[model samples]
Target: MRTKNFVLILLSSLSVLTFLDRNAISIAGHRITEELHLSESQFGWILTAFTLSYGLLEIPMGLWGDRSGEKRIITRIVATWSLLTALTGLATGFVSLFATRFIFGAGEAGAYPNTAIAIRKWFPLQERAKAQAFVWMASRLGGALAPLLIVPLQMQFGWRVTFFVLGGVGLAWVLVWHRLYPSESPLQDNTDQQQYVAPENDAPRWTVHLKDRNFWFLLVMYYCYACGVFFFISWLPKYLQAGRMIAEKDLSYSAALPFLLAAGGCLLGGWLSDHLVSRIGLNWGRKLVPVVGLSLSALLMLGCVAVDSNVAAVIMLALGLATMDVTAPVSWAIAIELAGKASGAVTGAMNTAGLLGGTIASLGVGYLISWTGSYDVPLIILAIQLLIGAFFASQLKVSTPRALDKT
Candidate 1:
């Protein structure tokens, strides 16, 4: 295989490992909650701990990736998170599990931003959305497979054992990543003394990103997007089992359904986004998909409440998730287009916004359940956020990164 394609595969594999470790908890939540004797609200806090730390640390770690290199930073990230994933299995109570998840989130913070850097470095501008789609599809694949894999494993061995096994998988990937991935460093060997400039020539001052109005627009848009989509990541399974009262034997398959459709959405969205960009133009091509997709997602989220059958509701919710995901590649592509050489930092900022949204959704779902004893209220709130996101998506304009323009 070609070198870049191989690297893409490795990056995709890393994305899989990352999602697998992250999603395992949700699938196994019933066992964990029962074993630990956690209330729904407390369980929400556990999920929030991961996302809260993940959001807060994304910029620093993404900046580090830009300055240092993905080779070093990714290795450390995988290793640290792997250790924490194992430690998660060892948690004897609420506080310990929450702490482990928080640290794990910190370690995993910059993963996608760094993946953006790798995509920018390896692929041409036109191909970025497709490459990003490929990477994100891997993420959905991991999420889709988690319930299918974890449920059976948890039944056989227990949630703790399942976590330990997942942790080992990450460590194995780190060893492979260290050996196979080429240098992402912009610096040349010291003996030759020739400078290896980053894509924008030199890295721009971080303040440039801070002051850009477009950056804030994209961040808020992403925040809205994250709030809606993360519902599946952290709480969907529990919602199905607890809220919808799905049978344990069938819960894994039903939970896997949304992520499976979402995986297809990423691929379709990526291909369509690239086609639109090539055929029409960036403004229409890049911006329109997200607006349309998010709007549909919003409608579907609301539709879920009207359905009476548990099976029908699950399908509607799955479609809602799938439609929302269709915009993901476009969002990431804009981050690259807007940031250029600072793709890592820019993507990081966007992801940080999204994770903060995730954090809120995580905690809010629990509180809403506690307050009203119904999942319908939380679903309605998320639907409104999706509509708000669609408006923000419409406002985004694709252009050269300010840093690149200055140079």
Candidate 2:
């Protein structure tokens, strides 16, 4: 097998473990809340703790990957987060859980940004979006699997044991990755890989992106989009149970449906974007998916809120996430296109914005639920954010990264 394909498989596997570990808390949220005797507002703070630290550290970790190399940095990231994931099972109160999740966020920071750097290194420009799709698809698969796997395990062995099992799974991946990742550059066909060197005097500074209007637009768009995404990640299970009156036994299937469809969305979006790019051009090809997808997703989210039947609400919510995710890979591809050699730092900045959005969603949803006495209010707010994101997506003006222009 080709080395790049092998590396992609490894990275995709890591993406699976990343979301599985990340989503476990949300899956086990009810039990955790009950056992800890935490209020909804406190629960929101716990979730926010992760996003806050994750956002704060994203750029630094991404810059670390760009300056050094992804292999070592990603290894450190997985190990630290895996250890923290296990330690989360030990928390006795709200403060302990909050601290563990915050530190876990720091450990998990830059994972995707580093993955973006690796994709830029190993895949040709045309293949990058598909590669990103596979990775993201795996993440959705992980999210889907969380309730399926965690519910049963936590029921049998307890939620804490479920986390221990997840932590062990991640550590095993770390060992496999260390052994399998290519020791040298894998692809010679990609000009970007061969031509871009980090130390060149004209190599674009990370700060240079600050001057680009497109960068700000990308950041804002992702910021708004992430609120929708993180709502699924951090709040969906609780919402399904408490807000929608989904029975506990049925939680796994109901919660898994959106992510299952979202996995497909990633694949469809990647293929559609690549095909569009071939038919037209990069600017429109990339822009079209997010604009159309997010608009539709927003409407569907409102439908989820408006529906009276539980089954109809579930379908609408599932479709909403699926449509929103259709833009995920193409958005990452745009970041890669914009940054080239600085892909790590640029994607990091974009994701920092995303995590900040997630931070707000995680905390705000809890408050909204408490204040409004319904989950509908938070969903409405998120849908509005998606509409704004679609507007920003439409406004993005694509240009070659300064680093690539120099080359």
Candidate 3:
């Protein structure tokens, strides 16, 4: 096979491992809480620790990838996080678990942003969104797989052992990646000339993005969107058990359903966005999916809450997550378009905003559950956030950068 295709496969594998390790904690959350004697609010703090450190380190890690190279940085990230993932199995209590996950987040912070940089380097403009879709689709595949794998493994061997196995899986991926990934970026002979690749001296300064109104709009849009999407990652298993009253035996399938549909949504969104870009142009093409998808998802979230039947609620919740995910690949594509040569830094900033939103959702859900004693309110609030994101996505004014003009 071609070298770029091989790179894409490796990158997609990394995406899968990233989410598998991430979702394992939530899948085993109930077991962990029971074993460790933790409260709802305390568990939220554990989740928050990861996101806070992850957000804090995202830009710095992305900048490292930008200045140095993604291959070296990504290798380090996976190795550190994988070791931390193993150490999580050894946590004695809340404090130890919190510290381990926080450092793990810092280790894993720049993963996708660096993957974005790799995509920018290896794929052409037209293919980038589809490439991003495949990567994200792999992540959802991991999410879907996590509950199926973790529930059984934890049931048999225990939660701690499940983490150790996952950590080993990540280390295995790192070794393969180090061995097979090209030392330099693959030739981009077929890449779009209209795409900007600024020289070392001419690269856009970080301050330039600060002045771009569209950049701020993108940040706000992603922040709101993350608040909604993170529910699947951080709380879905607990919600399935406590809120919907799903049995432990049924939890894996129920939780897996949403991510399976989300994988399809990523593909549909990427294909639709690319088709629209060909027909309408960049601004409207990129704008429409996020606006429509998020708006529809907000309504589905409300429907999930209003429905009386547990089955109906699960279906609605699954569809809501799937619809919201339809915006994921398109959003990354827009970040690349706006980034000039700073794909790593720009995507990093966007994801940092997302991690902040995820942090809020993780913490807020725990505290709100304690206060109100219902998960429904948090779902409603998240729906509102999605609506807010759709509004910002509508207002975004996207244009091809002037730097691309000369090419």
- TM-scores of all predicted structures: 0.94, 0.96, 0.95
lDDT of 2 at 265: 92
Root-mean-square deviation of Cα positions for candidate 2 versus the true structure, in angstroms: 2.5
- Report backbone clashes per prediction: 0, 0, 0
Which segments of model 2 are wrong by more than 4 Å?
187-203, 402-407
| Candidate 2 worst ten-residue window by lDDT | 194-203
Each model's lDDT comes to: 0.86, 0.90, 0.88
Over 4 Å off in model 3, which ranges? 186-203, 403-407
Task: For candidate 3, write residues 45-159 as lDDT tens digits.
Answer: 9888889999999988888998889999999999999999999999999999999999999999999999998998877667778889999898999999999999999999999
In model 1, residue pairs whose N, Cα or C atoms come closer than 3 Å (at least 3 residues apart or on different chains), thus clashing, are none
Residues 84-128 of candidate 2 have per-residue lDDT tens digits of: 999999999998999999999999999999999898877766777
Candidate with best lDDT: 2
**Residue 111 lDDT (model 2):** 97
Query: Which residue pairs come into collision in candidate 2?
Result: none
lDDT of 1 by residue, 229-287 (tens): 78999998898998898988898889999999998888888889999988998777888
